[model samples]
Target: MFILTLSETECRKMLADNRLARLACAKGKQPYVVPIYYAYAGDHLYAFSLPGRKIEWMRENPLVSVLVEECGHGEEWRSVIVDGRFEELPDRIGHKRERDRAWSLLSRHADWWEPGDLKPVTPPLSKYEPEVFFRISIDRLSGRAAKAA
Candidate 1:
């Protein structure tokens, strides 16, 4: 399939429609990639993680990369790649708010939080304070789209 560069408007549209992305982080010698739920607001992307692998990695190395992609039959596809530096928000209240916002976007695109699903809703900050909530201020963003021939 041939690739076509996407306009900023087109990239944002796809970003709004999809919430799951692959996040890449490196710590000196090792690199890690993980699936994460994210929300795009203005020029920043936000995500929340419990005290786990991703959080540990990010703490050690704040530089990260992310990829969001959509593919269909034939050559129909779109993808966006982002490179940025991550910042862990220090305010608990603001972190919780941003986490909820990110989860809302994820719920819209994926079944991670179906209305009647047996899964527990993400607890509010008052209940289960996330270990960390971070924002990635994008330094570079590139997107491509390809239509079926």
Candidate 2:
């Protein structure tokens, strides 16, 4: 098999094409990862979630990473890793424009609100749990593609 590094343009193209990624964040020595749907725009990834563990951890430490991957037939695969900082868009006057932008970008997908909108049945959350809109400002992008030799 052969593994090749993807260029900046290739990496960005992949990000733009994909909708789901594994979002990772760290607090002190502990790291957390979860699957999230996002919209790629300019140099940031816009996503939505409830006030949960990831939201809390990211607020405490803005540094985060995302992994997007695609697998094809016969051992062909590609993956990208993004290192970024998270910035929340609250429901306020100052962030209205950005919040709208996030909505507009994400709304293009048919099921954009799935999983994020889902709530746990047993461990019920508060009815007042606020929806969170945030962006991961991309700092770096690295990717690799593997193909059968």
Candidate 3:
């Protein structure tokens, strides 16, 4: 068989249907990727996380990428990559509406607030505090798929 590039519609559908992805961020010459759960709505991806390396990196450098994939049978697979900018939703004036919208989109999942909400095992993270909501404004997205002939 052969691989084919997925259209924008297909890529958006995949993103809307999947909640898990690898969130990639970088600072200077270093890069980092971590599993994350997100909600796709309009032109942004909403997600939550504790403050740490990933958060700090993104804060310093908003440029980020997200990779979502599905691998089924031996010869079937689909994956999508999104390049975008990250923006944190703070609980303050002027940003209330967007923050609420982000929350609404992510609340659809039963366990939407997870690992983010889980307490640190070894040491209660000092970085975890207040509300942590953010969105990734999609700049470019692409996908590919393959199936056995």
lDDT of 1 at 93: 70
Pick by TM-score: 1 or 3, better one: 3
Candidate 2, residue 81: how far the Cα is off, in Å: 0.6
Q: lDDT tens string, model 3, 24-143?
A: 999999999988889999899999886677889999999999999999699899999999999999899988999999889989999898756665468656553775899999999999
Candidate 1 minimal-lDDT segment of 10 residues:
112-121
Name the TM-score of candidate 3: 0.93
Judging by lDDT, tell me the better candidate of 1 and 2: 2
Lowest-sum lDDT 10-residue window in model 3: 119-128
lDDT agreement of model 3 with the native: 0.90
Which ranges of candidate 1 are over 4 A from the true structure?
92-130
Poorest 10 consecutive residues by lDDT, candidate 2? 117-126
Each prediction's whole-model lDDT (CA): 0.74, 0.95, 0.90
Q: Per-residue alpha-carbon lDDT of model 1 for 45-87, expressed as tens digits? A: 8776665666778888889999999987776988998899898
- lDDT over C-alpha atoms for residue 4 of model 1: 90
How well does candidate 2 score on lDDT at residue 48?
93
TM-score of 2: 0.96
Model 2, 1-149: lDDT tens digits are: 99999999999999999999999999999999999999999999999998888999999999999999999889999999999999999999999999999999999999897667776767776478879999999999999999999
